[model samples]
Target: MKLYIAEKPSLGRAIAAALPKPHRNCKTHIELGNGDVVSWCIGHILAQADPEDYDATLKKWRMESLPIVPEQWQLKPISRTRSQLTVLRKLVKQADEIIHAGDPDREGQLLVDEVIDYFNISKKKKSTIKRLLISDLNLPAVQRALKSLKPNSDFMPLSISALARSRADWLYGINLTRAYTLQGQKTGYNSVLSVGRVQTPLLGLVVRREQEIAKFNSKAFYQVQAHLSLQVNEAVSFTAKWQPSDNCQPYCDEEGRVLVRALAENVVKRIDNQPATVSKLESNEKQQAAPLPFNLSQLQISAAKQFSMNAKLVLDVCQTLYERHKLITYPRSDCRYLPKEQLKQARGIVNTLAKSSLPCNKPAQGANTSLVSKAWNDKKITAHHAIIPTEKSPENISLNTFEKNIYLMIVRQYLVQFYPAYIYQQTKISLLIAGGNFVSQAKIEKQQGWQVLFPKSKKTQAADEQEQTLPPLTKGQILHCQQGELLEKHTSPPQSFTDATLLAAMTGISRYVSDPAIKKVLKDTDGLGTDATRAGIIDLLFKRGFLQRHGKAITATEVGIALINALPEMATLPDMTAQWEATLTAISEKNASYLSFMQPLTKTVTEMVYSASQQSFAGLPKVAFKPKRGKGNFKKKTAKKPAKKSG
Candidate 1:
């Protein structure tokens, strides 16, 4: 009998629907008419055994057992899904042919492959196994995937990369968490001091930003604006900002802002009512193609900024749109470009959107289906394509506010692919007035094009004031400076981290690194964590009390600050994470071996354990532990009043 093991039940049902019909749904497996059966794992059926599981002595936290490295790793069935695993074990023994169906990503590949390894199948049987990769649950997409099955062995390197990541995380997170928690206890703080490869560095970013904000000293700066009238049209006048000359360096800051009030006042007096000549006038037409479709991180960042939604909430909404409604493709995809073949479905999808009740339905009618954007490129496609809307209409689908909003976002972004590029003319005017240079610039929109779909918000409309149109002027044309105005401004401190900015920082972490080589690697690898895990890692920090949210701003807690101050620089910086990610990418591409990566990692972990042991935690703050409430106890508890003073 042919057997298919899927990553999850929803995916199993999707695969079953694409296969030969006359399906019989059993308690654990779905049987097809042609003697084929399909079963699924509930996420991951197996997980790496914990440290205590390896040895009883390691169960208790002690400094002596600092670095516990397992010689022979073990996998234990998760208790919640043990029954489904049992069914799979029995089915694996009876199957004559097997097909491995998992999400086409690293974690997905490892989850399914590990299950097959647990079955202890013969090498001959393993070589015969086929792999099915499905990104979209739509029946048509699934059917297409079914016809293009490849050997499961072709993805062994991907599985191995995931395995290395898992073990590395274990060795790093587990050992450091235990070591730090022990250190915290020494300082009379009883709570667990959690440390992670990604989360700790993320916390460090917040703490450092807070420090920078606290230490910043506001400085006053001055500027001179020239109110000028064109000689050709006396009624047409515009304001130009004064650009300091090279000789003005002594009186200005490094950013070219005038620092001395006297210097700015002198420029204003010198340029007042002066006859100005237009020195240079340049105009250029520019076209901006619509942005590429949503990758998980990009979607999360947008949702956070537009709707004040957190990363975790956005991820959850995307999953619902992808899995339950089947209205979108995979939610965890990292690629923002679609395969060129996806362009063939553009007309059908646009038609469906136009007929739906979505917010973009009216705008969808204006989409030029024949106009292909640069977003369609086969070379840029990763494990899965961008998150885009399926051809399925949402007319009859019941959606809550969040789901509808997220679905609309996905549809709108996809619809933009069929729209024309936004066209505008950028004009720059440079003028000379009394030996000082003044400049004015404007962006005149020639065609709304794709921008017609997005109406400007109040903030955007306010920004447009700076780009007002300019009258016709030519170089060497004389103009009159009506007056000069001196404006004083002060430098502002950096803004606190918000959900949107934090996610953006995590996505483009390279900007924060000082080393050019490391920065380039981070840019190439796409930030600190994968799209599938970033939200979870951020959520985990909140659960561990490492991060707290106030309105839309996220801040580290006192304990969080203390822990960051106590750890070594390597533990708190993103440099190490960037290096590991680059190596993992190499492993996935089969350019690097697992041992070559793990050996250095193990040595690093050993050094970290020793380093952590030597660090003093005396300055760490003590934390009050909260007792766990029993189930069904929903009542709030009030603290008892302190007794009268014993004196």
Candidate 2:
């Protein structure tokens, strides 16, 4: 008997429908007719036990229990998700072959493996048992996976690492929450004291930025603009926008504007005019090749920017599209590129999409075979390739406005890759006035390239303007500006982080790190978190009250500020995470030992936890979960007492 264990009920249903002799048996749990019993996990059906789960005595928050460390991690079915657990437990005992049909990602791997280990499923041997892994839940994809069932042992290490992370987080979350909440109660407040493996670092990021803003010292600077005139066919003439000397900032204040006017009024500003010669005029054609595919992070960022969809929402939508609708490939991926072997099949998938019932433009050229970079290596691809649409275009699956937009974003990007590159011409013009120089430039596309799919982005500025080329000017051609206009402008403050910018910043934090090795490691790894969970991390911060959301901007609360300020060190932020991810990547690439890779992290986080506990708990305004309010204003934060030194 071949039993397929899906990640969710909808996926199990889809798998049953895909089978040849599919049947629905709902005696105790849903069983597939193909002699396969398919069951699933609604979410983390099982998880590391909390202290409350261990004993009632441990339930009460206490400080004497400083660090509640569990010698061996325990797993229990999640409370609300128990029904799914019942289904999963029943099928595991009876199935000869258990195919793991979870989403192919770290979290998914852990979810399935944890269940197997908890239920004491014997490791699948080569002859009798099997595990199925696939990114796409379509009929053909599932069939192919079924034909090639892998031994469960192949994914053992990944399962172990994932398990370790989950347990460690549970330990920190439960122990710390208890420790602080109890402390808060003693201090006269009952707010939840939130802490976690990834949440604290995220809170620190917001706090650090706030500090920089508060401590910033404002600076002033200047610019000048000249208003001039030219007779018809008489050549344009105007004062230079730049200051004559390099000693001062090039801005026009009230006095600077007057000086420019006096100089132009007197005609003495005709000090010097030197024509700027074009050193070289070169044009080269380049290809705008298709990208690999969308990973969770990249897709979420794109969706958020394009449709203003939140990260978690996007991930959930993509998951539905993949598992329920069976119309997209894996949604959680770190790779944006596809392997060469996938190229042929990718082309087939694109061609099929062209004819499929789904609303999409047929991608021309074999889109799959279109991967052109070293990034498309099969060796680097794991549980999934990248997020792409499946060949199967299932009918009328309803989606919300945001989900529809996100789905379109992925489909459109896929179609774009198969299209041609955007070809354009760039021109630069330089003028010399009063011996100073100024430059202007414009770019016009010859073709829209892959951008043609999205009409909004396809239109070039030149399309609305004139197709007529600029008047030809040779080297030594002295062309005067007919007019120069200057409008007074205030210096703009640094813009707050947006979804797109934040994702970009998160992925590129290694540049800010000082250590060369650390920087390089961070470079090789994604910034701090995986594309699958980065948004969730941010969301957790908001839920825990460490970060308060105001419109689109996220700011740290006073309590959040105090926590970071009290931290022993700042190494837990994105920079450090990037460095750790780098080492893990090395392990994946077989260039580093898992032990060496983990030792530093063990040392780092352990010290952070210790430092947190050793410090005096005095002075902290008990955990204040409620946002105190004053009439027409927020209440002031209570002053803190002096903290005792860590003993």
Tens digits of lDDT, candidate 2, 1-647: 66776676666666676675647656334655556666777767876666665666665555665465665557778788887677667677767777777766767777877776677866452234456777777777766666776776676555655554555456555555545445544555445556555666656666777777777664443344443223334544433344444432243444443234443333233423323333333344445555545777778777768777677788888877876676788888877766555555566667766665556644433243453444457777766677777776534567667666777777766666566666777765555555544544455668776666656543554565633334455656545344444433444455555666566666666754556766765563457666766888777665545667566666787777766654445433556656655555554445556567555655555555555556544555654543433222333332132111100
Model 1 misplaced regions, further than 4 Å: 232-236, 624-647
Best by lDDT: 1
RMSD of each: 5.3, 6.5
Model 1 scores what on Cα lDDT?
A: 0.85
How high is the lDDT of residue 58 in model 1?
80
Of candidate 1, the 10-residue stretch with the lowest lDDT total is 638-647
**What TM-score does candidate 2 get on C-alpha atoms?**
0.78
What TM-score goes with each of the models?
A: 0.93, 0.78
Q: Model 1, range 1-647, lDDT digits (tens) per residue? A: 99999999999999999988799998788999898999999998898888778998787788899898999999899999999999999999999999999888888999999999998999999999999988889998898889989999889988998899888888888888878778767877656667887888889999999999999999999999988886533653789999988898998878888899999999899987789999999999999999989998999998888889998999999888888989999889878999888887888889999998767789899999899898999988646789999987888899998998888888888988888889999999999999999999988999888888889998889899765578888899999998899999999999889988888888887777766787766664357777888898888767656677789889988768888998898899888776787688778888899998899999998999998888888877665332234322223222121111000
